[model samples]
Target chain A: MSILINKDTRVICQGITGKVGMFHTKGCLEYGTQMVGGVTPGKGGTTVEGLPVFDTVAEAVEQTGCDATMIFVPPAFTADAILEAVDAGLKTVIAITEGVPALDMVYVYEVVKRTGVNLVGPNCPGVITPEECKIGIMPGYIHKKGPVGVMSRSGTLTYEAVWQLSNLGLGQSTCVGLGGDPIVGTSFIDLFKMYQADDDTEAILMMGEIGGTAEEEAAAFVKQHVTKPVAAFIAGRTAPPGKRMGHAGAIISGGKGTATEKVAALEDAGIEVANGPADMGAALQRAMKRGR
Target chain B: MKVHEYQAKQILRDAGVAVPEGIVAKTPADAAAAFDKLGGSIAVVKAQIHAGGRGKGTLKEHPDQRGVQLVRSREEAEQVAARLIGNTLVTIQTGPEGKVVNQVLVEAGCNIARELYLGIVLDRSAAKPVVMASSEGGVEIEKVAEETPELIFKEHFTPDRGLDDFQVRKLCSKLNLAGASVSSAMRFMKGLCRVYSELDCSMAEINPLVVTADGELMALDAKISFDDNAIFRHPQLKELRDRTEEDPYELRAGDAGLSYVKLEGNIGCLVNGAGLAMSTMDLIKLHGGEPANFLDVGGGANVQQVTEAFRILLDDKNVKAVLVNIFGGIMRCTTIANALLEAYKSVGFNVPLVVRLEGTEVEQGRKIIADSDVDIITAEGLTDAAKKVVAAATGATA
Candidate 1:
């Protein structure tokens, strides 16, 4: 019933021997993510946490038959690692690594589109399907198996929303962080489509910010396609124009990509916009009740 | 990551693009010498600052002084440079405070001709680099794109594959260029595109790409910014970063591996991840408190980085209280808690402190804060943390 991954989905870790890779891989494994193997170039034939290791993604895929991969490579080599994963025919690749060059993502985005492999994030907090599996760096304790689908463009911000949703007793069917970069592998439209098709996901909660036209474009898609009830929160309402708040991509340029504009677009599409950060849960609860 | 006009022109010229001969000078004597060296009977003295609209900008100290001046003699160049070098130039782009001009660009002025706009930007929607050209130039391209959309033309280029000849030719036709000027313009645009890709530039703008009186193609002005993520690939390009033009606190924070932006408020926020930091600031403002700065310790920040972030926040005089919100993802709550105590011991914290720790090892993190001798107020959740921090800030200020 999960979108991209479940308990049975075998996973391969890229750059598994590195500090961050090892730490998060351990975390994911502890959450029962079905870790089969990992890849770390020269450190092949070594085991970090009782899993087999190989030199390249192809070798890891061949040895373990893993369909999904968790990339924890450094920012400089993340683009090449993603292309390698796609070339190896991995069905899903979730990159927890941040700061991949925007130009590199341009090429990776094209290749992934042609290959049909679902790429979640280059600067994101990977994906989680509650108690079944977790592929990102997010803490596993806050999630519970339920009906709502959560998606966001931030890491810790996503955690905050999920924590609030959990407190409100609206456990998530799945949560995905799309990453807060100028360019991302996954968009709100893509996640919305998946959520609409999944029967377990009765409602969707999106956390967006001011930056690119992705939110606007997603609003257009939701109006035309998505049938599920959707509640949204757009951050940076008070952010001054033209200043990049904290995210590299979250800047209002040429008088476009403002918070007010995004909120208006979402509202125009018949989606309910949360009044503020603390009001998201209440708004989504109302939307879910109204959907049926 | 944006470079001044003189620097942008140098990069463009290196890639074989046609640009006016220019030299950067720090003093009026240097500018006069450069004008004479360029065989100048007529030259342009331009104040070098990051913001655009310098041509129409006026000096802050002397209202009558302009940023860009056309001088016919060496003495005129010296006089203009002297007026601009030590003065502040206020432009439409630069705020009311404006930017201090430290250098002047002296170049051989071009003959009368038609001005056209040329630029390459990484279009997020297309997921590709796009080339934009318009018949209107020497003015804001944004205004033109908004007012007369059809006047601007665009061609998308794949990152793996660069711009082709036909794409450039098609763009030239859209500019209404014909004859030898068309071919020359095509070459110039293509060269600029090459520089854009090779340099890993996020934006490469040649505003007022002019066609000379004698049918020559020349780039009259250049504004370029490189992708910060891709800066590691190009070490030589890193040298072009103008530190003086940047905020000193932000620069120091960057060096310490913390993403920090100075804001005018009483509450200083230190959080993990950019999105969380922003939301934290929003929450503070919503709770009737203003955030003094936005500081993201990042996902993998260690004890040293955390200590530095604390010091930076404490250094701000307006900050009456500090809010530390950490969600243990790649980073653990216990690690951050230890760093907080260490920072307090070394740098000392005189301001009211509100700390909220969640996620992995929350019990141990809370225990560490409880055990510490330093005065700290712990919150149960985000809402509690925001309310407590706002109250502490107000209480202190009141």
Candidate 2:
């Protein structure tokens, strides 16, 4: 009933020989995800973490029949790795690498769209369906399998919300970190549709920061199609204009992408907005009451 | 990541796009020599800064001194350059603090029969590179879009294939370009697109794409900014970065693999993740405190980065308190706690400090901080941390 990934989903790690790749791959394995094999060009026929390593994604997919991939390739080669995965017919490709060039993403976006492949992030904290599967770098212990589906454009912020929900005795159906880049593979609206369709997800929690019209667009989509209870927290309200607050996408630019505008949009859509990060769980509880 | 006007023009000229001949002068003498070398009836001395709207901007030191001024004599060029190169130019884009103009671009003036706006940006909405054209030139494109939407024509092109010839022709026709000007516009638009894609530019704009009396289209003003992520591929473009135009703390943070933006406030923030860092700032403000700066130590930050972050925060004289919030994911809480203790010993914090650690290895991290005799305030949650830091910063009991 979890969206995107579950216990049955077999995963392969791209660039599994790299330091970060090996570390997270073992983490995922320890969390009980089916880490079938990995792809590291020039390191084929070798094994790490008791899993086989292939030269390319196609070889890994063919040998292990892996349905999904977690990419840890360097930013310079991340786009090509995603392309390789898509070309190998992977249904879900999650890129955890950050600093990927926007132009590379542009080309990758076009190809992914043409091929109808679901790409998750290039700078995100990956995805996790608590208890069933862990496919990202998110802490596994803070999660519990339950009714809420969580998604955010941040890494640690997502962990914050998930931890708060867990503390409230609320578990999650799945949590997706959509990355904090100006150009990410997945959007709020895209994940909204999936969370809405998942039977286990009775409510949705979305976290957004300033910069870009994705939040506004997601608000519009939620108002029309989403029937489940929904709550959101938009960060960077205190941010000054024209200053990039850490994230490339988190900025108040051109008199647009302000937190006030995003909050207004979400509230107008009838979604409960959390006053702050600590208030996210209570906000979702309020949303559930309203939905009932 | 933004380049000076003269540098942008040089890039444009190298890419086969027509631009006004310009020389970058670091001193008034160089400017005067540049003006003499151009040997034109009129020349322009434009102050070199990162921001746009320089033409309408004025010097802070001398109110009557404009950033961009037309000079008929070399002596006038020298005077204008002298005023601009050593003073701050306040513009609509630059804040009231403005930016110091260390150089000036002296270019030969041209005869403009008409002016139009042309720009290429990585349009997030369309998820493609878009070329926007408008007949209303020398005006803010945002104003033109807001006031008269139909006046703007756009063509979205993929980075792989670039803008098609037909798209360029359509844009030229939309701008009412005819005869020789049409071909010139084609070369200008296509070359600009090439520059955007090949150079991995985030934004490439020409404020006034001028049509001369002889029906030649030229980029009168150029603004080019490369994507910071892609700069690793272009070492040459990386060299174009003006260190003087940036905040020293921000530059230092960049070198240390941390993301930091200096703000005007009292509470210094060091956090993990950009979103969490911003949220920490928002929470601080909500609790009646202002944040001094936004610093994201980033995922997988090591001991050195944490110490560096502490040093940067302590370096800000406005900071009265420091808050460290970490929600470990790829970064473990224990690693951050260890880093914090390490930083406490190495950097030696004077300001009242509050730490909130959560996520992986939380218990161990808390125990590590609790066992330390480093004089730290520990909070269980983000809200508690914000309230405590604000109270401490304002010298109130929490």
- State which candidate has the highest TM-score: 2
The per-residue C-alpha lDDT of model 1 at residue B80 equals 94
Summarize candidate 2's per-residue lDDT along B1-398 as a digit string, tens digits. Answer: 88888999999999999998888899999999999999997999999999998988989999999899999999999999999988999999988999999999999999999999999988886789899999999999988987898999999998878889899889988999999998898889989999999999999999999999999999999999999999999998877888988888889998999999999999999999999999999999998999999999988899999999999999989999999999888888899999999998999778899999988888999999999899999998998999999999999323
Q: Which residue segments of model 1 deviate by more than 4 Å?
A: none
Superposed Cα deviation of residue B242, candidate 1 (Å): 2.1
TM-score of chain B of each: 0.96, 0.97
Task: State candidate 1's DockQ.
Answer: 0.72
Q: What's the true lDDT of residue A149 in model 1?
A: 95
Q: How many backbone clashes does candidate 1 have?
A: 0
* Candidate 1 lDDT, B252-341, residue by residue in tens: 998997888887898999999888887788888888889898889998788899889888999999999999999888788999999999
Candidate 2: residue B279 lDDT (0-100): 92
lDDT of 2 at B147: 89
